[model samples]
Target chain A: MASAIINGMPVEITPGETILEAAKKLSVKIPVLCKHPDLDATAACGICVVKIKATGRTLRACCTPIDSGMDIVTEDAELVQVRREVLELIMSKHPNECVTCARNQNCELQTLCADFDIRHMELPSLVPDIAKDTSNGTIELDPRKCVTCGRCVQVCQEKQNVWALSFLDRGIDTRIAPAGDISMAESPCVSCGQCSAHCPTGAIVECDETQKVWDKLIDPDVVCVAQIAPAVRVALGEAFGFAPGTNVTGKIYASFRRMGFKAVFDTNYGADVTIMEEGTEFVERFAHGKGALPLITSCCPAWVDFMEKYHNDMIPHFSSCKSPHEMVGALTKTYWAEREKIDPKKIFVLSVMPCTAKKWEVRRSADMSSSGYQDVDVSITTRELARMIKQAGIDFATIPEAQPDHLLGAYTGAGTIFGATGGVMEAAIRSALFLITGKNAANPNFEFTRGLKGIKTGSMQVAGKEVRIAVAHGLGNVETVLDEIRKAKAEGKEPPWHFVEVMACPGGCVGGGGQPYGVTDELRLKRAKGLYQEDGATLWRCSHDNPYVQQLYKEYLGKPLSEKSHHLLHTHYVQRPTYRR
Target chain B: MTTATTPNVQEDLQRIAKKWKDKPGSLIMVLHEVQERLGCVPRNVCLELAKLIDVPVARIYEVVTFYNYFKTEAPGKHILSVCTGTACHLKGASKVLESLSKELGIKEGESSADKEFHLQSVRCVGCCGMAPVVMVNGAIHGKLKPESSGKEIVAQYRGK
Candidate 1:
């Protein structure tokens, strides 16, 4: 190893290490777009140019190696000017639409521009006439705004392992698009929204539903009741400048009130209902040998969609219960409306989701209301709701902490954990234990399924039978788990798990596509902490103990799988075309 | 055409259901197999599968519509999957896509009027070193240049 003295710091470097790598070893930050750690260094950005002590020439630090005695100045005036010029050149061809663009506040390029104070473009703007792509269900792409950073491409190919987006054409005609310019819906996008998440500009964004939600709010006939998912509370705060794990449940309720919503409800209530129906369904399946073994969860729309299209062979394994948000919407019209003597036709259900799939979830004809209205009239992302709150000039942090409206707003800690990957399974165990053993669980925390593990499996004896369960989040993880199960079945071994929970996002609902921007491993765990804390703080931690749910079963619904419950709370799955274009 | 009776769809679903009756999540697996065989996921198949699985039919329908990949209608003869991964972006995959769309005279995700070609974009195919990759009927083609004068990719598929 060779040692170098740069910027008054002694840094040890490998034989042929670059000045940039040595600088990084000394805890120095060198900003360069074209100098990704994984990608081969092109040094085209020129932002990482550094001044050498002895040599008058400014060298591209990313590509240049550090000699043992080399002394480098990364923040000299000449280097600063060179970096500024480089950024300006990059900005010349970039769209100046950050003010009103979808990625306006959340863009990395815009942030860099602000940081460098490069307000005006000295060079001529190359405004290409490119049509925007609204063909995708989850994200829209604006070609004119693309800087061709290839971050979306890198993430799609390297991170998500889904190589759907790519750049095409020569020079001025170059634009990012799917191979063969296919509609994203027809593409194998999987609606992960990672492309939009990684995009440095407004080139990509989750489909905008802000105006539609506002329009519904103004319609007097539409008594809009908003339901916020468990994950939304943890991540929604990030859009409003709150810390990642900050619990914004109270703030969300207050903001919805300010937004003119008739009632603020919790999707966890619906989650609780899902647990009841899904748990009972699982029990029935196990007892009667009715449905598939090792029933998989159906709450994640993305997972459901994936199974329907690519893995329809696994449909019987999916539980027949609707997602928590849809369940809440369905019950709001049926169970809640009947209780309040409100017309189901007048009520509008809005879900504040952390998922793009929720948009598709609400559109299913099978999830329609018996009252002839869409069960969930609108689905808005956590980001969208944050925009609305900001647009209204409401101080989210200062808003009076308010509790959700009665009954539907009330949820147990188990329900709150439904936001994380293993939350659904943990919540189910709490209730399932009570259902089976007729007592409080010996261990309230099913710690086996908790944390950031990609896939977790646990088995517990209930009524002398080992009830095995597996929890998986993210589509990639789901594929691995399914593959394992397939292999097991091929070996003639009984499936290891009786119930499984799958969330499409990496960390479950907390990391949903529609969640607040800039999600990291630390942020997901923080959000998960908030969820578990909320679960621990709640009195009724078990689904079976939820009084409102108990009342619904006793009064309106009769039982979990009763004929009325089946028509309303419980739903079905459909096999989709395997070979989609 | 078969009548829209529940039993009819059940019979269609049973054809596949009988194959995976004992497997875990057999209903979903059978549905996938049937969809693979049928080109489109028919409502009758879903209904029959739901009944066989003993879950509510609504749940089955919900899963079908919730995902973007699931198609409720029949597909065309040839499936064209364009690669949109990062390496392809650097190699100008978008222009290749545009050229294909123009050559095919149809938008992405659309079947040709003749019902011969169905175009779609897929996430990464794990072939970053080879930028601008396209998978037509599962055959991977790399380093594609979308030239106006070039022989249209769809024409070759039509001849096939």
Candidate 2:
């Protein structure tokens, strides 16, 4: 450990910890423009420069590792002047249309400028004239407002392993663009929306589809049906003054009702249905040897798109079961429509997902309309839902808590945990054991299948057979697991895993690309802990124990893989080229 | 698709990949070899190279756009580069570039409409003594009237 005297305060620094991190311990905010807590410091902005008394030189605090005997002054008149100049320069390049920008109040750059008390720009504006690229439909790239922070590009290329974005050209012309200047729709983008999640400026953001939902809600004949995803409950409270991990499921249901929805359902109930179908499929494969071993979960649409684009060879291993939201959407249009005596065409299902890819997933294929209409009419993000709640003038805190609609709303612990990484594997194992042995495991919580480890692998005793399983999140970590599976298969060896679960974003749905901004590892864990707490509190810990899910299978769909279940609850995949052209 | 004139572009790229595919910092090396043969790198060829090298197409484009040596679009029948080094700039290189652009009816770093002349400004050509040099198809014309030489040299190529 390196000890340093930072800003007249003694601090202990661990190895590889930067000066910025060291300052953070002492409650000293070393202002950074391009530095994110989750990413390595690119040192592109040059705003976090701090003076070293010993060397008599300023170093970028974000990248400079603290050394012993270093006397660092993070704040001084001179340092403030330098940082002010840097901010002014950055603002000069940034567009002057902050009033019209989506990130007007929530932007990091705007916050930094406020901290520095920057009054007016000394330098002239030199913002680019590039047109906004809404080609991706799920995300927008407003190049004119870009400060060239490289956060979005780093997250896309390194964190997600989808190299659809790049810092094209150099010097004054340097800007983020989909590779080869091709539209993001044609590029190898999975529509995870992580770029928007990490972007500090208005350069990248989730495509605002709130207007479309509002229009549908105002339609005279259209019935606005809403479903909230498992991850949304634990995160949507952040828009209000609630803490990060607060469970506002009841509050969110009430808010949706207050905002004008005919019925408010929970996506967790859909997740239970997914577990029923996915667990049955796993049992058939493991016990009766029906289909492919190592059945990969397809609930995360971003991961599904990634698998199809980058690793289509694993198509046989991918579970054909539709994601929970789509399952709920399809069922809402069919069974719910038939039972409610409403016209299926007039019923509009809008899912409030913790994902942006669900926007694209709604229109993926004809199978999405197995209920004779589009399964999901529209998919809004958790962030967008929060905006709509406020726009509807609903006092979230004052609203009385209410329960979700019974027919498609009841969920067990197994379904709720789907928001966390390794959650699907844990939830599936909980019910799969019962499907195979007719008994639930004593301990529903699988400690090995938790946390932010890139790839998790383990084996469990199932009906006297050792079933190997693996869980992977953050698209970059999946290649390692898939390569291992490929190596085993190529040599005709026993499959290394009998089951696999994948989520494209870092911390499953809880840390999705469409969640709140300023997300870090600590926040991810906190948000995931909220889901786990919900899981712990619920009486029914296994998906098989969810009575409402069982009733649905018995009444509407005959069984998990029955003809009607396959028709409305499963989907297919196609090997798509990385470049559409 | 690769241009028809370079029918063996695929095999040539495969050969380059064989030489540098597994090596680190080999993107620029492979690109140099491709540029040596093709005069300019096409987007489709880079997309193909991305697969052969097991790198993303965006990465190839990042490197290709960075360096001034590699051209993405096909160059004209005649390539013209005006030296803009410190020595050349002091010797009126801007005037030389201006006259060339006027005669060619295209800006710097762009090709003419007829695709007969490609003009670009270069940092240095390693001949500071030949200040304000204009390279026409690799034949350097130096130490002349900046205005006349730029127009006169391209006129020579046009007449031929």
Candidate 3:
């Protein structure tokens, strides 16, 4: 332990803790721009500079480790002056397009400027006219607005291990770009949006599709139907006054109605349908000795894209089921459209997702067009949906609670928990056991496969046969789990797992790229807790128990892997080139 | 002086990697060796080095771009460097650079059409007394005026 006096207040801290972090423990507020709770301090922005009374030197509080017996003054007259000068210098190079920027109200730079009471423009502004890149159609990269904080670069390379973003040149000419100066589409970007998630400014953000949705909503010819993802329900409340994990699914349904959507559905319904398909496939592989062993979930589109590019060998193991939102989209276009006597072509299916990858996934292949038109017309992120709610002047917090449309709306507790890490695996296990033994899972919770661990392993006994399961979230963490299986396969040894579930974003979809910004583990846990609570409070706790799902199988789709289900619910993947050129 | 094929570049990068094998923070040193042999570190060479050294290509590019010493383009046969330091600048080094550029018909930092010479501006060469210094291939010429003397130096190099 290291003891220090911060502003004449003695504080104890652990070794290797940064002074900024120590000060945070002591409730000291040190302003920082480049430092983020989710990333390591780059010290790129020098605003968090502090003076040491004994040494008479100013050090960056974000990166500098505190030493014992250190006398530190975080805020003094000279420190404030230097910090202000640093901010002015940063602002000089940054574009003053805040009013027109996407992050107009929520930008960290704007917040800091307000806190410091910056009034005058002391330095000559030099905003370089770097072109905006909208190549991927999922996220936009405006290099002109970039502050070069290195947070996006850090998240891309270190945390996500994507290596899609990097500093291209030196010093003042330094700009964040794809590593080899290629477009984002050409790079190995999975369109995960973690870069946008970690960015402090409006330099990187989701491609706004709210205007298109609004256009469709106001059109007399268009019958707009919306579906909210499991993760969206848990995290959308953060945009309002509610806490991070507060489940406002009911309020969201009401909001969609006010926003002019004809009907609102829940992606949890699709999640239940996915378990039916994936669980059956797992049983066939494990019990019937058909298909590949260790079936991997294919719900997360970013993970699917990552597999198609980096780990193509794992393609056979990937479950052919479409993601939950896509499933709901297909059902809405075909099943719901037919039931309501509406034209499938005229039905505009919109998906509200907690993922940027979903925006790309909508137009990925013909399978998304299985209903004769695109299964989903527009996929808006949870953040985009929040903006739409605000734009419509709907008080989200006080909105009356309403239920989703009855056709594809009813879901189970297993579906609600799909927002969290290890959730899909747990949901799959609950149904896979029922498929094998012809009975409901003894313990529907599947308690072993839950939490924020990067990779989790557990075992379940189905029909007196042991089934090994592994769950991994975060693209970087997927490598270790994959390498282990590859090594075992090469050595002709027993496989490490019989089933695997992977979510590309850290902490699953709750900590997704398009979730509320400024996410931390605490927020991920709270959001995950909200889902689990919804699961516990629900009448039906198993996917197989969803009456609507059973009705779908009985009325439209014959069975889990029937030809109709395979045509509409399943999709194929091809090995993709990492670079477009 | 030479362009390396795919196999040759891989082999050369492998040799460089062997020298820095099991060494921590040796990517920059390996990259230096690659630039020394090939005149510049090309994209393929960087990819090869990243594979051999078990580092990401993005990280290699980060290190390469951070240092101005590392060149990404092949340099010319005879490099002409004019000192642009404070002392040299005060002594009309900019005018000397201008005259040299006009005489050679090539802008600063560009190679001549014949691929013989490349003009560049640099900081001090550690001799303030010899302000307005020009170095051609490490042979320093001091105290040369921008007018005729700088043009004569370019003409001399052209004839070589």
Candidate 4:
């Protein structure tokens, strides 16, 4: 360890550590634009440049290695001028679109401009004359506001392993784009929304469905029903100024009612239905050797779309089940409408989702209404819902807690956990174990499937057979797990897992692309904690235990895999063209 | 399709994968190697390499399609990649791109019908000192004038 005096405070750091790393240990705030903790320091931005000593040599704190007896001045006058100049140069190319931008208050660049008290750019602003691309269905990109920070590129490539974006062209003409300058929809983007999630400016954002949802609510002829995903409860609170792990399920239900949603339903009810069909399919497949082993969950639309486009070869491994949201959409337009004596066309089924892909998923041709209408009329993100509440002049925090309407809203703890990464796998195991053994398993709390870990695997005895299961969240992690399976199959060995649940986004729906921004590892875990707490407090903790789901199966669908259930609940995958063949 | 037993090609891929297996950002390294060997990271190569490394082919495809460096489809005979870093941006790379687009008769990222040349632009190549740099088949040409004709560059490659 080397000791250094920074701003008159002595701090100890590892011998080879950078000055920025040492300062971070000492709890000193240092503004950095080009320096990411996970990436190599480019020092191109020159914003983290600091004064070394009386010698007046300014060095980039991020790139410079720490040495013994080093005297560092982080906020010297000369250093401030250089930093200000760097900021000015960055500001010159940046479009002054902050006020009306989606990331107006959340932008890091905007915050830095405020922190540095930079009133105007000394250089002329060179805003790019590029048209906004809204082809991706989930995200919009306005190149004019881009500062070419390459943070979005790094995050897409390094973290998510979905390098759908990069900087294209040389100096003055440089811009971020997919290969071939193709529209985002034309590109192999999975609609995971990670690029939008990491973007520091208004350059990228999830598609806003706020107006469409509002129109549905105000229509006197329409009966609008809102279904909230399990993850929304954990994250909706953040938009209302609540902490990361705050559970605001009741409050969310109340707000939806105030917003004129005739019925506030729970997607968890549909999640329970999903678990039954998926679990039963797994058992039947394992017995008959008819279906693909290690069946991958298709609840996450981003994962499904990614498989459809790139990994079409592995489509057989995916379970033929619609996501909980899509299932609820189908049920609302069919069974639920019949029970309520409401016309299918008159009912508008809206989903409050934590995923940007849900917006795309609801529009899928296979997820269409049997009554000649779209299954889900509209899907709005958790962030968009917050905007709607604010727009409606409703104070979410002070709103009286309310309950979701019965039938669809009556969901068990297992269904509520669909928010977190390993949630679906855990929910499946709860019902699978019960169905296999005709009794609940010895351990109801499956702790293995309840963390922020990228991938988790476990085995348990079910019906006198050992069933191996693997759970992977994040497309990158799914890649690793799939590779292992391929290698195993090549060796003439049976794959380890009988079932696999893969969520495209990290930490599952809780860390979805449509959630509030600035989510880190800590924030994802906090959100997961909230999901488990919701599970713990619920009266019923198993998917099979959800009486409403069981009633739906008995009264309407007949059984889990009945022909009626298959028509509404199940779907197939499509293989797409690859460059190789 | 002619399967000419290109053991060297397969060996080259394995060698690249081995070199980057333990490195940070192995995916990018693999992509760089694949692009270098094939002049573009073909989707088949990505699928095969992904299978070899035991990673999801989707991940390999995602990286190849995501980064501007990795070309999914084949480029024209002469691939021209222009750098558009902040330094190049200040030096009028857009005018150069516009001029190139007109001369090549194809927009950026597109190849001409004759397959003689493909024009594309990349982000910073870490050569900010050279305001406008263009790379053709791994060779760097620094400080290009914005008004330089794209046909002239293509002619030079054709001559070579």
Candidates, DockQ: 0.03, 0.67, 0.40, 0.08
For model 1, how does the per-residue alpha-carbon lDDT over A41-99 read when each residue is reduced to its tens digit? 55656778888777867888888988887888877677767778878987887878777
Tens digits of lDDT, candidate 3, A1-581: 66998988999988898999999988999999999887888889999999898786999999999999899999888888898888889899998888999999899998988788788888998888789999999999999999999998998888888888889888898999886667898888999999999899999999999989988989999999999999999899989978989989999999999988899899999999999999899889999989887799999999999899889999888899999999999999999988889999899999999999999999999999999899999998999999999999999878899989977999999999999998888888888888878888666887778888889998967777888989999898999999999999999998899999999998999999999898888899999999999999999988999999999999999999999999999999999966554
**Model 4 lDDT per residue over B23-107, tens place:** 7667887788788788887655765686567565545655565556667777897778888888888988787788778887799
Q: What are the lDDT scores of the predictions, listed in order?
A: 0.77, 0.90, 0.89, 0.81
Shift in Å, residue A565, candidate 2 = 0.4
lDDT of 2 by residue, A1-581 (tens): 55889988899988888899889999998888898887999999999999987676999999999998789999889999999999999999888777888888889999999999988988988888898999878988999888898999999999999999999999988999987778889889999999999999889888889999889889889998999998898999998978998999999989878878999888999999999999999998889999888899999999999999999999999899999999999999988999999999999899999899999999999989999999998998999988899899999988889998989999999999999999999999999999999998989989889999988889988878999999999999999999999999999998999999999999899999899888999999999999999999998999989999988988899889999999999999999888886
- Residue A26 error, candidate 1, Å: 6.3
Model 1 docking category: incorrect
Cα misplacement distance, residue A61 of candidate 4 (Å): 3.7
Model 3 chain B lDDT-worst window of ten:
B1-10
Worst 10-residue lDDT window for candidate 3 chain A reads A441-450
- DockQ of candidate 1? 0.03
**Residue A131 alpha-carbon offset, candidate 2, angstroms:** 1.4
For model 2 the TM-score comes to: 0.97
Of 1 and 4, the candidate ranking higher by lDDT: 4
Evaluated with lDDT, which candidate comes out highest?
2
- Candidate 3 lDDT score at position A478: 93
